[model samples]
Target chain A: MPIIVNLDVMMARRKMSLTELSERVGITMANLSILKTGKAKAVRLETLEAICRVLNCQPGDILEFVEE
Target chain B: MNIKSKLAGIIINVSSFVIITGYGYTLYPSGIHNWMYSYKETDSLNLPVSQYEALNDSILTMRNLKNGYGFDHDNGQFAYLGTQTSIACDTCSYTWFKNNTQTYNQNYIKLNAWGIKKELPYKFYVKNKQGYVRKAVPVKNSDSKFNIVDVPVKFRYNTMDDAILIPVSADGASLFDTGWLILWGLNMIGLLFLLYLFIRFSYDTSKGRLFTRKNVTRLKLIAVSVTVYPLSIILLNLLVRFVFRQYFSPEVVLKDMVWYNAYIVLLIGIVLSLLYGAYNRAQLLQEEQDLTV
Candidate 1:
């Protein structure tokens, strides 16, 4: 619960829509939506690598931690 | 899928559907009707043999004729026990005959047989109109007044070898009161509930809701209900055993092949409960999988 996913912020910075990102990242939009909406239980290392490569951002930029 | 596999799947599905429908149809009302109406009016009676003296005289005359014909009337003990377990079926047996008003509370009759004289040869006889019948029951060899001669049973219930609990009215007038409803009515209701649970299970399965919390709960309930079904049968027998002991007071012996039947259903229920546990774990895993991106 402390780990917050900030995938939508990175997508907005890259000016990419969820459908275009999902198609480019070779994953379903539903799964990408799950990650974007912070509903994903775990982010696979390969998936994070693909999303980082497509969005041209570090994993730290997409994922943030909050003490609450 | 391949054509062969598809065809086989269709065949299996069609056959299963037909079989289930056919089975349900056959079990609707008549199957239960037989169980409810198995006992007839003559099944229970106070005077098992009305004209004991007349029957004895007739047997003696026949024996005399047999002696003249150089045939021996073998005096043997017929150890045939009467099938009617409930001797208190009619109001006369308990209330009027016993002259007890309070006996109506424990109306069912449980009959127990003891002191079987094996030495007495069983005599088979063919009367003029009565056709074939047991010739004569041997009189009291000892001081005990009752002897079980024959038992003709048409019951799906347990082989209740105890006292009979008849349903009687308050004033000891009517034989059949609401006790039959307690037996047959409750059986019908239980059966309907089981059918409903099965339908719900099938509906949930068809809807692809197999590994859900509600399904697991339903499965648990189904298992418990199945287990309770057999247990209710045992409880009914035990209830009869308990109620039979209230008045006139006889030793109780509850032994029947059907009594052992509960163990089989109990084993099935245990298996279902284990399935319920497995399904719950599977549901948790499914939820986790769904949550993962």
Candidate 2:
């Protein structure tokens, strides 16, 4: 619960559409939307790696540790 | 599913249906069941007059002490048909006296007087081992045999108040004559409920709804029915024993209670509960997988 997803902020900074990122990362828009909306319970390392590679960002840029 | 789980489910379902159907067939008739439960002693009622008189004189006596209607030793120790009695001992008190009796509104007390009272006009059946008929008898000929066990019996007597009529050394008042009927009714209700729940579960499974919320609820319901049905019946049996102790012996009720018949349900309940847990976890995993990237 303390781990918060910041995928929307990174995507915004990259000025990329979810549809483009999904196509580049070989993941569905639904899964990308779930990650963006912070609804995903987990992210596979391969999926994270693909998203980082496609978005040109680190995993830390899309995921953040929140104390609360 | 492996062959074992599939086989287990099939066995439980089929066995339950078969047993429920078997109960329907076996318990619908009174004579057939009585014949099934019939003791080896077919000639128990062939006692001579002198021996019966001697037994009446020596042993303690229980009369037809009911005010309105009562069992002819079929329902309890006291009955309506004059003062009909079936068994002398306490152990077999629920034993059918197996004869006819007539109603009387007089207060009569004589241990050996049922011989004349048995010849009154009207007739009603009293069940048990052969005992004296103190009520009025209209047709004493061979035609009377047809009327036996055909009449519905009713019971009326306080469990505690009847204690005075029973001797301390006597075995006790008992009622096992119609216990099978109660057991049969309960089993039918339980089995029907089980069938209903199972049908829905099967429908969900057929639609590939396994590990869904609906399936989880179905599994839980089935498990609860399987577990609660037998337990409630046993509790009712125990309740009968406790509540009927004033008139009918608890031991006799316990002996005929349908506790053992539904034990298989409990075992199946355990299996379903385990399945429910697995299904619940599987459902959670499925949800997580769907939401996770």
Which candidate has the highest TM-score of all? 1
lDDT of 1 at B161: 25
Model 1 per-residue lDDT tens digits across residues A1-68: 88899988998899999999999999898899888888888888899999999999999999999999
lDDT tens string, model 2, A1-68? 78889888888889988898899999988888888888889899999999899888898988899998
lDDT of 1 by residue, B158-235 (tens): 122222222233343122223443456666786787778778888998999889888888888888887887777666
Best candidate (score: lDDT): 1
Clash numbers, per candidate: 25, 11
Which candidate should be chosen as best, given DockQ against the real structure? 2
What is each predicted model's overall lDDT from 0 to 1? 0.49, 0.48
Looking at model 2 chain B, which ten-residue stretch has the lowest summed lDDT?
B107-116
lDDT of 2 by residue, B1-293 (tens): 79965654454343333432344344334442222121112224354566434333222122232222123232322111112232232222111222334322221111110111123222222235221222322456765443322222233222212211111211222123234445556667867876877788788889987778877877887877777766775665445445435533211223211344556768887888899889889999888888878
In candidate 1, position B95 carries an lDDT of 14
Q: How close is candidate 1 to the true structure, as a TM-score?
A: 0.52
Candidate 2: TM-score of chain A is 0.93
- Where does candidate 1 stray beyond 4 Å? B1-187, B203-209, B236-240, B248-250
